[model samples]
Target chain A: MSDAKFHLYYWPGLPGRGEFVRLVLEEAGADWVDVGLLPESQGGGARAMMEALGQGAVPAYAPPVLKVGDLEIAQAPNICSYLGERFGLVPPDEAARLHARQFQLTVADVVAEAHDTHHPIAVMKTYEEQKEPAKAHAEVFRTQRIPKYLGYFERVLKANTRGGGRYLIGSDFSYPELGLFQIVEGLLYAFPNAMRRIASQVPGVMALRERIAERPRIAAYKSSKRAQPFNPKGIFRHYAELDEPNAMK
Target chain B: MSDAKFHLYYWPGLPGRGEFVRLVLEEAGADWVDVGLLPESQGGGARAMMEALGQGAVPAYAPPVLKVGDLEIAQAPNICSYLGERFGLVPPDEAARLHARQFQLTVADVVAEAHDTHHPIAVMKTYEEQKEPAKAHAEVFRTQRIPKYLGYFERVLKANTRGGGRYLIGSDFSYPELGLFQIVEGLLYAFPNAMRRIASQVPGVMALRERIAERPRIAAYKSSKRAQPFNPKGIFRHYAELDEPNAMK
Candidate 1:
C-alpha cells in the first residue's frame, strides 16, 4: 500500500454518498483522512474537491476518488474496488472478485434511484420544484426496482455455495455487503413503510443489513458521532409524500 | 487466453454504451461475438445475450460488460482495465496504469452525460415526456460539462509524456480513447454548434478525437458497416431545441 493516509474529498455532513467509502475504510481499519472534514469549513471544502474533481482528462471523473501522491482515482464503486483490492477484502479468485463488483454496481443503481427520489427532474432544478416527479419516481423505485434488486441479491445469497454467512462472499463482512446495508438503510430512511413491507419479503437482504450493521467497525461508527443520519439533502431523502404506503405498490 | 470467445451484450442498434468493450476487443484482434446484432428478426439473439449478461456478478453489475467463460466483468472503465491488463493495452507500470484508469473514468463520466442527452430525467420515461426537462439538462451538459471534461483530458494528454502520440495513453490507441471519441462524436452529433464552438477552444480534445477517428482499426470498422450512426435511440439525441449556439456561447 502507498504510504501516508489516503485522502478522501467529500461533503462532510450527512455521511452522504461518501459514507460508503468511509464506512469501508472504518471496517478495513484503513488510515484515511476525510479531506473535506479537515476543518476547512472557512472556505475550501467540497468546492476544492469539486474543483479538483473537475480537473484533468476526465472531469466527471473526480470526487469520491482516493489518492496516494500522484495516483488519483474516482468513481464510487471503482474506489471501492481499488480499496478492496488493497485491503485483501476482495476475493483472490477472479470469479469471486467479479461477483463482488457486480454486487457493488447493483447497489449503486439503487442508490442512484434513491438520489432521484429527491431530484427526479434535473439536479439543476430545486428539489422542491421536482418534488412531485421525485415522489412518482420513488414510487416506481420502491414498488418495482427495490424488489427487483433485492430479489436478485437474495438469489445471489442463496446461490452462494461458500455457505453460511451474512456477508455476500462469506460469514465475514465484505465491503459489498457494507454498501448494501447503506443502500437499504437509506431506502428505509427515505421510504420506511415501503422498505419494511417489501424488505420483509427479502429475508436474505434484511438479515444482511442487520449483520452488517452489527459489525464492530460499523457499530462503532454508528455509535460514534461520526456517522450522520439520512436526510433530504442526500441521496436517500426522507420525503413523506414519497414514502406513502402503497404509493408504488 | 481463455477457452471461450469473449461475448459482449449491449443494445445492438447503436454503438452506445457497449461500444467501448467492442473497440477494445477489435483493437486487440481478440475473438469475440457481438450477441446483440445477431439477427433481431429471429428470437434468441439479443435475448440470449441479455440473459447471459445478467449472469454472474461483475459485468452482471451492468451492461457493456464482457464475459470470458465463468468471468463476466462489468463497469465500463473497470472492464477497460481488465481487458487492458490482459491485452497489454494498459501501461505495465503501476502509477501509469492507475493514472490511465483515472483518465478513463473521466471519459466514462462524459459518456454518461452523452446518454443523459436523450433521457435526462429517468430511463423509464419516454423522450417525449422528458423533452422539456431534458432540454435544460442537455443545455447545461453541452455548455458546462463538455468543455470541462474535454479540457481536463487535454491536460492529461499534455502530462503523459511517455504516453507518446495524441492517444490518451500515447503511441497507440488504448480502448478507452476509442470510447472517448465515441463520446465526443456523440456529443458532436447531438450538439454540433455547441461542440464546434467548444471544440475550437480545446484543440487537444478536438485533435485527439480526429486522430482517434482516423485510426486504421476505427477507420476499418467505420467503413465496414459495423459502425452505426449516432441516433435518437442512443444517448446523444440531436434535438434542434437543445443545441442553441448564441445562448450557449
Candidate 2:
C-alpha cells in the first residue's frame, strides 16, 4: 500500500506552509515522499520544487503541492480536504465536511497573518528591510487577530455536540484538528508572549493541541529527525522586538 | 424565480468580502437577498448580519455567509464553491473542480494581502492609527505582490487549454472566473495607480475581465441597484498615501 507513496513538493530547510500538510500525512500514517528530503540529484530540494511548480500546466500559485497519482493540487486546506476524504479523516456528513474546510481555511488565514508579522511588506523583501513595519504588524497580530481567531475556535470546540470538544468537527479526530495543533505550535513559537496571554482564554484549544501531540504516531513524528524545527526563515519567526506585545503603542 | 432567493449576510455600505459571493450569485442568476440591504426591523443591516452570524450553530468566523434553505456556510470561497455547484458554475470533473478550488483559494490569498495593505497593523484599529505601517506595506504590495499575483494568473490563463483563456477553468465559465473579475475590479478601484502599470503586462487577465463584464447576466447585475458601489470601508480601500507606488524608501 505504501509502495507508490504520494509526492509532496515544498521548499527544504523550513516547515513553512508545508508543515500543515506534513502534519496530516504523518498523523494518517500515509506513505508519502517529502521531495525536499530526497537527494538533489534525484529531482529533490528547492530547485526541483520550483521547476515542478513552474512547469505545471494548471500552474499552482505557490508551493506545498500534493501529487497523488495523476491529480496534483495546491493550497493547504484544499490538499487536506482531499486527503481527508481519501483517509476517512473528515466528517461523514456533507455539511460537516464543508465546516471542516472552513476551519482549515481559517487556519490558513492565521498562518498567513503570522507570516506577515515578520514580513509586513512582502515575502520577497528581507525582514531587515521591513522591520519597522513588521513591528507594527506583529503587535496587531498578537493582540487582535490571534485572540479573535483562536477564541472563535475555542467557542467552536465548546459548542461541538460531537467528540466532547476534543475534535474540531464531529466525534472523529479529523485533519482540521491537526491544522489547529500546528497553529498552536507555530503561535507558541512565534509569539510566545502574546500566546501566553491567549493560552488562559483558549484552554480548549490548548488541550486539543496537547492531545494531538500525545497521539502515538504524532509523538513519534515530532521526536523524529524528519520533524523540522521552527526557524527564523520560516513563516513563524520570533524576533524579540516584534514578539513583544506592547510595542505598537 | 427571484422570489425565494438565497440570503446573504454581510456588512452594509461596502461590498467588502461579500462582493465575491454577490458576483457569483448574480452571474448565476440565482435569486438572492442581501440581508444587509433590508431594514433593521426586518432583519437587515449590520446588526442583522451580526446577529445571524452569531446564531448559526456551525458558527461562521466572518460574514459573506450564504443561507440556502437550512445550509448556511461562510468564507467567501466556500460560499462561492457551494453556489458554483448549485448553479452549475463549477467544472464537472473532480480534478478540475479541485483545480478550480485552488484558483479560488489563491484569489482569497491576494484579497487578504490587499486588505492588509490598508490595515497592516490591525483591523480593530482605525486606518489613521495604522497609516504609517500601511504606507510601508502598501508600497511593497504595489511594487511586488500585485505584479506577482497578476502575472501568475496571466500564466494560468495562457496555460488554460479550456475556454482558450476566456474562463479560468474549462471551456465553460466557473465561479473562480467571477472571483478573478472581482479581484481585478477591486484592484482597479483601490490601487488605480499601480494597476495601470501592471495592466500592460497581464493582457490575458485583462481580457478575461472584459469577457466576464460583458456577459449579459453580469452586465445586468452591475447596472441594477443591488450592485453596491465600492466604498472606503470595504476590503479594497483607496488611501491616497497608501496607493502611491513610489512612496516607500
lDDT per residue as tens, model 1, B176-216 = 67667777888888888887788877787788788877888
What is candidate 1's lDDT per residue for A1-249, written digit by digit as tens? 224478777776676768888887888888877776655563346676676665543333456867656667667776776678679886677766666766776676677667766775565667888666666667778777788888877776766646463457754556788888988888888888888788778998899888888888889988887677776677777877877665445
lDDT of candidate 2 over A18-133, digit per residue (tens): 98898888888898988887788887888888877867768888899988877789988898888887788886777887888888899998898888888877678799988888
Native-to-model Cα distance after best TM-score fit, residue B119 in candidate 1, in Å: 2.4
The RMSD of every model to the true structure, in order and in angstroms, is 3.8, 3.1
The TM-scores of all predictions, comma-separated, are 0.87, 0.95
Maximum-lDDT candidate:
2
lDDT of 2 by residue, B1-249 (tens): 124569999988888889888988888888788989988777788888888776776788899788877777888888888788778888678888898889999999989998988888777878888887788788889888899999999988888776687667777778899889889999999998888888999999998899889999899988989888888888898877877653233
Give me the displacement of residue B153 in model 1, in angstroms. 2.4
DockQ of each: 0.34, 0.69
- Model 1: what TM-score? 0.87
Which stretches of candidate 2 lie above 4 Å from their native place? A1-3, A245-249, B1-5, B245-249
Worst 10 residues of 1 chain B by lDDT: B53-62
